[model samples]
Target: MLQKVPKQYLAQTRNIFHCNCKIKIPIEFSEELLERAFEVLEEIDLKYNSYVSGSYFSCINENRGNWTPIDQDCVEMIRMIKKVSLITKGHYDITCMPLLQLWGFYKENNHSLPKKDELATALEKVNFRSIAIEGLNVKIGAEQEIITGSFIKAFAVDKTIAFLKSHGVADAIINAGGSTISSLNDASHTAWKINIPDALSKDVFKTGLQINSQTFSLSGSIDNNLLIDGKKYGHILDCITGYPAENLQTGVLTKSAFLGDVLSTALFTVPATIRDEVIAELKQHFDFDYFIIDNDHKKIVTECFQYLR
Candidate 1:
């Protein structure tokens, strides 16, 4: 049980399923514990995934007017979705699927920008207000469904960390794709240091995150992208305009990558005029620290980012 060797597995079909992860679970992780961890990760992928047609959100959309109340796990995720939506003033909405599908980020069909009239039409179908949730029961209006599959990475990290800890994984780190979460035991000697890719170049390393304690989540658009009409498009969608984020090149460092990943995506779509206000709001609500990389690739670090170093 005290062995130093670690086991590594690559999931074949999640969003970043193509991206491999090096899991540093303890040797004491029993066969049952390992199976449970895999099952938990798979469930997170299945229940929260947006691309899957049979997923909860997709099921709700298919059943529209019938109205189905999700289980507790979904309720919790929706709660955060609503909270973050309000904090971002609707810029971080989860109901941006219409716009997301129209743009073809998942489909990879690479459609051109929609005409103003077309965009306006799609925008009509996009509204977070259409979703109504009361305790265990959630109802979707005639035209809306909740999609938080993308939102689940951080949640998965949180849930996975909880699972690992419950299974006696005291000193462990779960790196699901680029999202990283870790817990340290008093006896563990090393800090978890993760290196982020450069905002400008993947060939070069940009910065390092060294965590002594606490949960951290991060999302950025340095790598995931497409080029249309000579303009580059990042995977982070603008919930307001329903288009890929183009302004912010990369975002790193946050209190919860769960929120950080969502914010990083939201920040990409936010207008320059309101960024200062957004930053202030983030600092006020979550006590989260951030490091934002602008279009020019300049780094802006919050007060607590020093701890990440």
Candidate 2:
């Protein structure tokens, strides 16, 4: 049964979910419902967070050569990850922990860059094909690790929204650090307005978004890029080159936060020469809305995005 909170009782809480990002879920302020939301967050962190010592991803990394048992939920996540990696030509890889470590993003308070030799060594172990998932089992290469830096937070929000909706808690929003947004319904049954941030100049425009039944994800080098010397390097690295991806920023609105997360990263990392083909291939699985700024600062705003405005 749904306990309806009075209109005056609307509230929200923030907590550190997976990836150390705060998850803000707006609710009707029922104590039991609030606790249930926290429980969902806790469950996801314990089972799938790679940073956690005993999590399934950690177990898979520590025992790379051996097949590690995974839960069905983990299996579903991996399957989606594999599909994204494949269609993007390995640009959107889950086996990216080594690359992150080499680039100094994996560790806190570290600003070191890897030497050429060290970069080469790490690149040798980075490949999506190295990860094999069958049923509830997963195996990686001897040194490969799957890092969900791009997807885990969104996954957590998606699941939390699912839990809320099941409890008759509709018409809410889940925002994770202003990057991923999940909605059970439009903001109070109105268009969920959003201002698309400009990647280069950091300007905000008046024409925002009106979203419904969707999760929106935006990826860019500016938000989380590394400034090494005079060079700007994106946190997103190419699984093939083992280097930071080219200058790019992209936004995707889709039915699933998992898909939006993967697609946004993939769009940012995939080679520009063949990006359209990859997007075309992705369409067979999902038709989505996107906003992309290319290396030349050329904005590619799809029709789907314009229609939302």
| Top candidate (lDDT) | 2
TM-score of 2: 0.88
**Pairs that collide, model 1:** 217-257, 218-257
lDDT of each: 0.64, 0.77
Error of 1 at 174 (Å): 0.8
Candidate 1 residue runs with Cα over 4 Å from true position:
1-19, 181-188, 249-257, 306-309
Misplaced by over 4 Å in model 2 are 1-9, 18-29, 107-115, 186-188, 201-207, 307-309
In candidate 2, which residue pairs clash? none
In the range 175-263, model 2's lDDT, one tens digit per residue, is 77667887777456644556767677546553467678788898887766676776777788888888888847789999898789889
Pick out the ten consecutive residues of candidate 2 with the lowest summed lDDT.
Answer: 18-27
- Candidate 2, residue 19: lDDT: 29
lDDT of the structure predicted as candidate 2? 0.77
